[model samples]
Target: MTQLKAGDPAPNFSAKDEQGNTISLGDYKGKKLVVFFYPKASTPGCTVEACNLNDNFERFQSLGYEILGVSADSAKRQSNFKTKYGFQYPLLADEDKAVIEAFGVWGPKKFMGKEYDGIHRTTFVIDEKGVIENVITKVKTKDHTAQILAD
Candidate 1:
């Protein structure tokens, strides 16, 4: 798949949320979206990043942006993570990795000298028209909300 860049139209997809509700990119038409892809749900870095976003969720909403986090974890795992972190936004389960691959966030990763295929930590700022406004490839989990807000 081609690497997605700013101005590229985001791939529309319908995925299952933690609560088993269906969520589609088209459902947010005419609204800005922050679509974030993380390696795993409830991991240290992922948890911090999720909580940071949760803390600033109202701010994003105030700016007319809806936040959605995706991972290859199962729905149960996503639900547990959301409940544990008090996440106000939806967390989509992408066990099939279709959305992840479509966004070009699923690929080989290296950590501690071991390489494996997985979801890369990335985020996309999609505009109301479904065009990608910005691609945040280097995400710092601890302060992700402030970083995105600053951008």
Candidate 2:
């Protein structure tokens, strides 16, 4: 996968959120946005990462950041995940992988010694003008907020 870096122009995307609302990059025009890509919905690692972000949701908002979770899951699955955890932010359902490929997070991955193509866990902090301020490829699932705040 082509890994995005800090200062790269965040690729534009328009996908449906868990609520079926169309969320586009342009919507966050004048605000910083946190776009997190996870491999799956309700998985162990994904759960921890998502909950950590949600637990600090208010703080992130206070810091002027709007969060959006993305995954190649169906809208129903995304909705279920969000509802189960009571996540405060919208989770994008990128079933078509359009957004995933745009962000360059989809590629070969190894798990338990088996190689396969999948989505990589990544987080992008986009500035008000839509430029990436930081791209966390080595994401700390439980302390992601700090990574963004550190920038």
Candidate 3:
């Protein structure tokens, strides 16, 4: 997979969120954004990352950042996860992998000696002008908010 880097132009994407609302990168035009990709919705690691972001949601907002979570799961599944966790941000259901591929986070992954293609947990911090300000490749799920705040 092609890894995105800081200062690179973030790939534009339009997809349905958990509520079936159409969300696009353009919607955050002239605003800071945190677009994170996870392997699946409602999974343990994904939950931790998302909840941490939610817990610190106000801090991020105060810093003028909007969070968006993305996964290649169905809209219904995304909705369930969001409701269950009370996430304040929208979760994009990129079932078609359109957004996932645009971010270039999909590729070969190995788990417990098993190999397969999957989404790489990545977080892209985009500036107001759509330039990537930071790319957190080595995410600390439990402390992701701190990481973003640090950057």
TM-score winner: 3
For model 2, residues 39-145, the per-residue Cα lDDT tens digits are 99999999999999999999999888999999999999999999999999999999999999999999999999999999999989999999999888988998888
**CA lDDT, every prediction?**
0.91, 0.93, 0.94
TM-score of 1: 0.96
Root-mean-square deviation of candidate 3: 0.8
lDDT of 1 by residue, 23-128 (tens): 9999999999999999999889999999989999999999999999999999999999999889999999999988888898887788999999988899999999
Comparing 1 and 2 on lDDT, the stronger one: 2
| 2 or 3, greater by TM-score | 3
Q: What residue pairs are clashing in model 1? A: none
Task: Give the range where candidate 2 is weakest over 10 consecutive residues by summed lDDT.
Answer: 1-10
Error of 1 at 38 (Å): 0.5
Q: Would you list the clashing residue pairs of candidate 2?
A: none
